[model samples]
Target: MGIVKAAMAEEESKRQTAVEILMKVGFLDHCEHHEEIIFTVGGDEEVTGAYKYGNANWTAYQGSFKDRKDMTDHIKQESENSDYANDGCEICRSMFEKD
Candidate 1:
């Protein structure tokens, strides 16, 4: 029964992993899963966040989130404080926290 139990455990782990990957990539709809998770956001690269889909590390989709709150919050938290700011429009600037 040990082998059977181990196999079941491994299958359960993989199933959970797949769900996490799908959710991380924006297929799942809500922050409840990560509501309490610590976030470490960084600078505004060509894209803001990375998600894994299938077997790949994927950047956030353009116009994915309903609003910028999730993205902006992540960016503000991740990005180091910078004196050099990009000249951005209202829409673009909304994605970054104002000083």
Candidate 2:
């Protein structure tokens, strides 16, 4: 594979691992929005996990069960952060924005 394709595959692998961890910890549902795949654990609209892609890098933020709300809030805030938004890659944007 080409270097860029390889990198994307690696990033996807990282995101899949994060999803498994979050699901194991009770994050039951997930949806793609902008540059993030947001996972929810329970009744709250808060996030239990976030898989973020920007600048050709992927970042996984997982919330602890005991402090899930805070983590979710942080994820939400980070998603809207100017730095992240400005650095987002077009490929990542196209992949996630379809839904």
Candidate 3:
């Protein structure tokens, strides 16, 4: 393949890997919006909110996970000191309540 084609292919591979990691970490539901695949946390759109994974913003989210293990570890760390109720984030409260 040409240089540009090879580079595009590699980026696409990384994007697919990121999607798999997110889904394995409980972000199973996703939707396409404005050329981006927005994955909802905990499979709920209204509760846990969503993360945009696409060409434009992939770099930001991609760095957070080297693999599925890393992605899950990040979630565990975030939940360790999470203050859903006291923080006044209704979505967070609802998400925790569902657990």
Candidate 4:
């Protein structure tokens, strides 16, 4: 079991490094599943990007932005097109319905 433990430790180390890099780039929320990490960029209030890290690399899984304006435009468009009834949690659906 020593070899298995060592491999697990190495993977944990890699995950920590990836988390550090993501945090530096403004990704504050993350979910880990096996070898993959999914990140929500620019905080929970407004996610400017969605990224994934695995196999020692980072990928912009959702969309890429050229600048702050581009990011803002994308967020605005997404908000306008969002179907909260179908997409969001119960609380979010209630909040959107109340708006």
Clashes of each: 2, 0, 0, 0
Tens-digit lDDT string for candidate 2 (1-99): 999998787655544554444344443333433425443433222232342221112233332222344444434444343432233355566877996
Worst 10 residues of 2 by lDDT: 51-60
CA lDDT of every candidate: 0.36, 0.41, 0.44, 0.40
Q: Which ten residues in a row have the lowest lDDT in candidate 4?
A: 54-63
Q: 58 in model 4: Cα distance from truth in Å?
A: 14
- List CA RMSD, all candidates: 16.1, 12.5, 12.9, 13.3
Model 2, position 41: C-alpha lDDT score:
38
Top model by lDDT, which number? 3
Off by over 4 Å in 2: 30-39, 43-99
Candidate 3 TM-score, true structure as reference: 0.34
What is candidate 1's lDDT per residue for 1-99, written digit by digit as tens? 699997787555543443343335433222234342322222333123322133233233323333344434333332332321322233334545554
Task: Kindly give the stretch of ten consecutive residues in candidate 3 with the minimal lDDT sum.
Answer: 78-87
For residue 17, model 1's alpha carbon misses the true position, in angstroms, by 0.5
TM-score for each of the candidates = 0.33, 0.34, 0.34, 0.32
Q: Can you give the lDDT of residue 26 in candidate 3?
A: 55
Using TM-score as the yardstick, the better of models 1 and 3 is 3
